[model samples]
Target: MNHFQTGRVSTNKNYFLMFLGRKGDSMIEQEIQGASVAWFKIAELIARREREKALGVCRLLAHSFPDRAYELQLEGDILWALEDTLAKDRYTQAAQLYEHNERWVEAIALYEHITTIYPIDYTALADLLFCYAMGNAYDLFTTLCNTLLHKTQTGMLSDTNYTTIMHQAQEKLQKYPTSQHTAWVNDFILWAATK
Candidate 1:
């Protein structure tokens, strides 16, 4: 009779463990479904130009899935939109967000990313170059300048190309004043003149 009771007790324990396991799995599934719903709501808010609400949703998603690249990118986009809509200093915040995600290249590139869509955007290019220099990617800076110079020669760049490149070089010189980067930029300008 004692052996029968021990067997029954063991069976009961096994059943309890299986029940708990199923419960845990169901909870995880429910949480994932909740997260998906939240993400959908965020996308809706962003599309509707409800910037603050969208940003709040992005923040919550970011917190929930700290390592998710899509969530991080959404957060960055929200910040960018906020900056644009509010006419605020969004570049620094965007750069910080990229940095937090360990996307140093993108962050540095943003500092100088320019579109010929705006004739006066040379300043943005200069800013990007300075950021790259600050990030200690001297090789990348040199490569970019060379590429731009080549594009100008090929007539691929707009008529404003030469002035823009020169302006960028000069701006970088001011930022790195007495550094080797300044000297390098100066030398490149001189070389361009010779060519």
Candidate 2:
């Protein structure tokens, strides 16, 4: 080969090797693959009251990351800020994924939002109660249980499903080792029995 051609080829090969041998390549790849940085931009757009642009980004995010609950949740939050009822639908979808994955904190937050949007949504209430028990948030569970009892007194949560949810909670508590409800679980079951 000519001298100039040989030098150019060697330089290109060195550049390629440097790119391949770069440290933290996997970390760079993870940053590129993760959604946090993009979500931050979208959040900034929302904070700036650029709802339309933020909403467009939210839709794109949901489409690109279909399996992740956080994407839909962001969309739902934007919709809520816009006072759109479709927020609930998006929140419901996200909540289902979170619940299915046993991500109790995210599911609980979404379910709480759903309940505020629909205080009489018995299914959401049941789901929230189930999450509370599973997460071992006994204080919250007991407080909500009393409120639910009052709701029943007002003929609000009078359906058979409430009783079924109670039974489900009882069954969940009955599960050994995994259940942290070692001490007060029996009392909770008794409380359900009286309901």
Candidate 3:
């Protein structure tokens, strides 16, 4: 007997989300702002300690705005607050989403968060390295690259991740030809090549 209903959304969550997904681009864009408002309001519910309703809102948010990842940090926070083990998974997924969307800074932040929370999440470390490099956070990039190599001296890094790391670093190598990190980048590239 709940009462929150709108022109396109309804209590039947899946149906509402389906409608939105199938709608024309103009309508979807028009509703983005409204959905964003609803997204933030869920934070208020969590702040008020309305756990059940907040969870409901979170489900709606996940379904209705699957592609809109701006609220992922909030989602991870809410899930963490609720003692849900899926919190870290959500954070990692958010990082991937940020990466896919090419929001490098946000992706880096999320990856950093994931690594701190799950220090053994080697994939995150790999992803973070490439992101820091591509985003021109050269200081953090080089620092983490050295740290990762030294720490994983026992060959713990997977081959796929190594290739990914190499590709990401090499893709942007020419950008800094005259820079101080030039020799350093080439040195690493040659090192990776020999490996």
Best by lDDT: 2
Clash numbers, per candidate = 2, 0, 0
- Candidate 3 — which residues are off by over 4 angstroms? 1-52, 59-67, 153-186, 189-195
1-195: candidate 2 lDDT, tens digit per residue:
753566775546445545667555565566566657668878798778787898887776676555678877888888787777888888989998998898988888999889888887766776787777777777888887778767666877774755665665556556646546534545664775676
Instruction: Order candidates by lDDT, high to low.
Output: 2, 3, 1
**Number of the top-ranking candidate, with TM-score as the measure:** 2
Which pairs clash inside model 1?
111-128, 112-128
RMSD of 3: 12.1
Residue-wise lDDT of candidate 1 within 18-38, one digit each (tens)? 655755556667878988998
TM-score of each: 0.52, 0.59, 0.54
For residues 1-195, write the lDDT of model 3, one tens digit per residue.
Answer: 332444544446556556557555567666787678776877788778777787677767666645656566767878777767788887888888888887999999988988887777766776787677657788897787666566456577655665566555555444544454445555765775564
lDDT of 1 at 26: 65
The C-alpha RMSD of each candidate to the native structure, in angstroms, is: 10.5, 10.1, 12.1
Error of 3 at 180 (Å): 14
> In model 3, which range of ten residues has the least summed lDDT?
1-10
**Total colliding residue pairs, candidate 1:** 2
C-alpha-based local distance difference test score of model 1? 0.62
